[model samples]
Target: MPPPQTTGIYPSDSITEVAQSLPLDPLGAGSADLLAGDVEYRLHLIIQEAKKFMVNGKRGTLMPEDVEYAMDALNVEPILIPPRPLPLPQFQALTIPSSSSHPQQIYHLPDDEIDFATYLKQPLPAGVANSSGVKWKAHWLAVEGVQPAIKENPNPTQRGASRPQPSSTSLRPQARTQLPQELQLYFTRLTTALVPPSPTGPETEPERHRLAALTSLRTDVAVAGILVYVVKWLGESIQKCLMAPTGTIGQLVDAVEALVGNEGVFLEPYVHILLPPLMSIILTVPLGPHPSSSSSNQPSPYDLRLHASQVLGKVAEKYGRSYPGLVPRLISTLSKSLNSPPFPSPLGASNPPSGRYEGSLLALSCLGKQAVKSTVWGKAGENISRIDDLAGRLYTDGGGKKRNPLIRALIKCLSVIINPKPVDITPQANLDDVSEAFGPNLANMLNKKLWTASEILRLRREELEGEGEGGGVDGMEVDQA
Candidate 1:
């Protein structure tokens, strides 16, 4: 008989499309009619039964009302198939054979057959007879293998009697108790021969050699002493130079730059001292009396301020993360400078001199960089906000129409604050806002300067990823470039 053509029943186009798109005889049979009989009919029956199971209480077979009830309950359009009389005898006959084979399978016994406690207590078979007995034997063998051959004594002392006793002497040969008197004299004579002659006498070769060695050691000691003294002196000199109005700002700046430029010096223990004084100098510069004022006639200290600011900026660029305490102070100093007027202008204008404004802006920019550091971000979100607020004010009040150096400085500061690197520190609300405000600007600027900034951002990301792979941040920075 020719098979009935497949028909669509679903309300939506999707289901009908799916059914039609399915190739007829997907199993590649020559005719679609091959899927039309008992096998296909049984599959349809199972699906209908499953749908009935999901809705109506189970009965022997699904009824027409049950299908209608399911369609309404599930909110699906009804799908109908022609019903065939249930082949109860055929199904019963198939089950009879399968049920008869079940009893012979004792190993895969049902739970009803298993008395778990009795099975556990049963004596292990003397030898493997069946699969169950073999499994029991295998388990026993594993347990036996793991059992300790020599039982440990619960009351035993921590150290066993078998432990080796310490010997009176070391295993290595002891150094000779004492040099022979003649050998000691011979060494003394040899040492004397190496010493150079001194002014007092026509010394023997031994005496002269001994003198020479002593003189060389003395000279080296003096040189070392001089170096130590000079370092202390230089440190003091730099400190005085920073504080004194008479001190040469040029010399102090050159010294600071030299000290910082030498990577070794910057990383040294004493570098901390160099920073605060240098930072102080930088801070003091922008706040110095304006060059246009009567005070400007008296060799303005403005140049000193510029040098200080430059040094501070360099320090921040190189070691901002390493020295966290410096960041807040730098920010505070920059803030004060930004708020203060340049020395009173000759024209009585409240505005600072151009140079003072420029220096102050540069200092603020450096502070911005420090504020963006991860350590700072983690704990000083408020500080970051302060930097943003200051920069925003400078940008807004200063006006974007003019291309002043201060504007450029403010822009740089904004960039640093916005696109801060992620650090171990948790960010505060203020910090988050600052980061958000600056982030878009950073993104735009970074996109334009991607070639230059890519490596830096990549390194920062790598550091962040590496931080996760590693346990935590404690020892991580030691290995960072």
Candidate 2:
């Protein structure tokens, strides 16, 4: 028995038109119809085979590569195929008149023209590096409702020790084992709450966290166990944020300030660790990349220096008497920064950034009037005189802006030399004496009032000595009479 024939879903006229495109005679309607049916049957067979490959590959969708594999399996010629997922060419339409007196638009891909000379001359583009493989690091997410004592977790507020008095020495060995689980949880949450999730701008949330952290540092007595850890963390954080943006550096400095202000912490033991980072912020040249002069919206690097200097002043004032060497060491450091030659001698070489010099001056002024008097009128005064000369030259060199910060710093230092209440017996001195004492260049920078102040500060010791001698002479005469 013969089976019924299946009809071709594709149009026979389309098949005839395609045949006309070949270098052969036109096809008759019956031949075109037979060819269309055979072509449609072959297409269906290829698709069915492609689906088998797709099913075997565990993909429900039949990809172009599956079709290629299917053609190979069927022992049939496949069309030219590029790699899968490559970019395809754009299609253009062409209009042609058909036998039905209507124009038909056939879509075809256009060829891309290449210039071999340019292509050969150009360097091959760089291929992307393969990404690092997936990685896993083991850390406890939580242990019995308490966070682990590890770097991955926030440091606990109160570390435990076996001894009655919890010292840093005792806390280190038993930090993990001795902490109560409840205290461990509280420490984790407290530290977590101290840091804002996003510390980008001057947002309210970060400010709140910052204030809260500072308050806790100043007022919380129970945090004594973790005092050592907090100091270490603050030092590390300040070092890390040295090259950070404005708000970031300021944030860490505020933390340090709060720690210094914490009366209960007894920070003298850790001052060695804490002081260097603060000094670095104060003395490091170009504390991170500065924004361009046109970018006035952001705070300049000097503001951070000023704030750090204030904190440094507090540290010195609080500990100066106990550690007499502290003030001298600070002065020595600032002197080194000042002693560097102001001008770059070599043509291509450059002087240190003026910001460093300014910071040194500001820090010196913060020490005390005696420190300022020594730097101005004592042997170290030579450096300030040289800086004054440099400032003058810089002003005449056509960029006065370069000298402005240094001049401001010097002015602030001079302003600090005056006593709050002037003594009537103090000798009066004019600008000539001031010029001879502080150099003519620095003298010109000062006003008459500063000159008087400088003189009072300079002659204060002499006046007191003369008074003591005269009083002794009068007492000796009265006893003899």
Candidate 3:
């Protein structure tokens, strides 16, 4: 009667078909329907239990091994029996290795050895370089033998640096660590060109891939996963760009601008990799000179900075809203790099001095966008203030480098911080024609004010010292003033 109305998980007729198909129809006719009902009920119970295993493991897909593991945990024997392994040929079981023979060896049997020659024959893709980058730094925790690389804090380096290498001396366990081959070659070619800055602009390949990546950044949901690659490419390009001011440095700058300005994609994920290279370029001394100049091939230090400045400026603009730590971190990095009371403000070639930093001053001006002015002033103002005090205290009547680029940059950065945006003035106000004091103009004011302050303080102190030295006037009065 209409297959029992097909209401149950399994219809009676379907069960009868199963029963009839069996060699001996042990459950005859109506009885098959009863058995089917019982089977379906048990199956439902097994699945409900199986799902618990899935959730506990934090996996969406169910695996056979998981079912077996779950069943064992539940105190229920699994239905599927795993096949027995082929018996090992009887050679007497090997005991622990003798200390005298090979003390380095544990008790592994010869049969367990792998066939290296056979595996070695497998071919790898062409132009694939071994990325032997990540190395374990020696660090100790609770005990000597326990490696910090393992157990916790596994990988300290970003993914882009060399792939993780297997440590030979690492405690007991170690984990050993592709761009396409042609793409790899193109990146290499690009870096080489940057280092030398030959006449050839980068081949179309890198530019094409960069465009592709930019496109994918907009459309692809999985772009975040491969951000390491993108960051690496741009960082390396910036690094190379910093090395020399010629060749196709502009392309690298463009790459940085594009990556930073990409609207939809969030670079917050890869900022760690991105920031270091960009900063290094920003502050790295002697950005390569112009290729064409015979007298001094290197571009003017200021010129070198302009490239770095544009990139850093774009980054600050895009990320200033989301990431608060950037400006503060940048100050610390710049502060440490400076030669506190810095080498007396880079004297130019004309002064028979070591270098010039006008370019750096200009670059820093670009970086001080209006977005994070207050944060820069409040959060990092102290460091700049300290440097300012030092720079002033050490100031002399003589001007060597014309200005301290670091101090000048800080001053320009401070002005922007103090006045985050352009000051609105009435048409009749005295300052209407004025623009922001950026670059050399700002540097001139900063250098003058600092020099003036130092000179006045020194003169007053000198006068007091001279009076004390001669007439021995009240020392207490001089000290109080």
Candidate 4:
């Protein structure tokens, strides 16, 4: 007769065999040491799983249900099951440092221990001589200690101007008061870079991955630097970008994007300071043709139009709520784009030409979708009406035909804004009007297509729980080999 299936044993003995083969006491260590090692390994695994859950927007404790689903989906036996940890608490609480304390402590190595000149001369990646990483690290070290070389320089005025001067007092109370601003700046830049760009051009997967990593690092540093200087610097940079003429805007936007992408680690610490001001500029920049056209023959303002669209799209994704003033400008821009003249289509006569106007229209639609639930929009109240007008203009009779890709993209954006779902409820005034205008077709599409990480996890958990209750026979099953 076959072994009782109720033993919770599988027909395959492979798992049991591997378990038996693991070192019982190969190092001659006692059970205490072995148990400690096992606990550590289990903790690491738990942390990893928690990270995945957090990425999927699952907040709070790792319930048995979450663990079971994670194990089944990942096709692995978790080292320790949920509820096994006697003091099992929310993973986020453990992983994230408290606001009262520093997330990371700066370690200052004595100047004599490492020669800065020699360190700078070491072999580096090609084309990295001017890399921001090198400069940022040097700056960090110089500022970390009380008696840093920069501080002890003979010319006090020159030294102070070249680098961030340390606080005169070593009082813990004073340091604590000053840290939050510095940290905010660092996080702002990091978040901006981390936000995935909308599909605008042909970029390979590897390039995308590289950009994400760079942004993540920059955000970390920016978060750390949350100081007045960082905030001011960020604000000034954004102002310059906003004030730039159409002829120069494209180059400026490109420079900001490139810097954020390449030196993410170096910039991470300044994100908080940089983000708010950058967002302000993006929101407030005047839309439409340049104040004064340089010449009728100058590249038709296509490059500026494209760059502006791309920058606004990025800003909307990252900092939509911080600058209420920008929403009207965004709606105005899209309205103009939809009304602009047609250009030659990219995909031949089969599709309508997607000119700078179309691109801007699509970008504006994306921005509105992002801002649907933003606090700024809620406060402004009138912006939603403007968004509705833009939406109506794009899809209604006075607007062009509805079958184009540009139209489809606009519809998708409106759907997202009108029904952001679990993340945010559509405002009643906008919802009633938008729903009536778009009717059941657009509403159904939005409801069917929208899927956030939290929603996905909920579905997976439900499926797994259903299987567990049915003796594992009712659902598809997988086990680690």
User: Runs in model 3 with CA error above 4 Å?
Assistant: 1-197, 200-227, 247-250, 264-266, 289-299, 343-481
- Evaluate all candidate structures by whole-model CA lDDT and list the values in order: 0.44, 0.66, 0.48, 0.42
* lDDT (tens digit, per residue) of candidate 2 on 1-481: 4433447687878888888888888775378778878888898999998887788789988888879877855546677777757887688999987888788999998888999778666644444223354233468966644466677765433222221111122223224443666545545544454444444444677667667777887787756666655666667666765545555567667778887888877788778778898888887765643332334443577777888888899999999998989999999888887766654321122443566777887888888887787774354244456776766654554323334667667767766766554565544556676566455555655554564436543655565677799899999999999
TM-score of 4: 0.26
Off by over 4 Å in 1: 1-251, 263-267, 285-307, 313-324, 332-361, 367-404, 417-481
Best by TM-score: 2
Local distance difference test, candidate 3:
0.48
**TM-scores across all candidates?**
0.28, 0.50, 0.37, 0.26
lDDT measured at residue 25 in model 3 versus the true structure, 0 to 100: 42
Task: Sort all candidates by TM-score, best to worst.
Answer: 2, 3, 1, 4
lDDT of 3 by residue, 1-481 (tens): 3335224577667777776788864664457667778878766766776777677679998767667755643335676855556565545445565658754433443556768776555554444434454333444552432224444434323213432211121111111112444444444443333223233323555445545544444455444434445556566556654434333344455555665666656677666667776666556544443222453433455444566676776776667678888755664554344432334222112222222233334444565544323332333223334444444444433323445444544555544433222357321211111112122232344443443223323333555577667664566567778
| Candidates arranged by lDDT, highest first | 2, 3, 1, 4
RMSD of 1: 35.2
Superposition error at 407 for model 1 (Å): 2.3
Predicted candidate 4, C-alpha RMSD: 25.8
Output the number of the lDDT-best candidate: 2
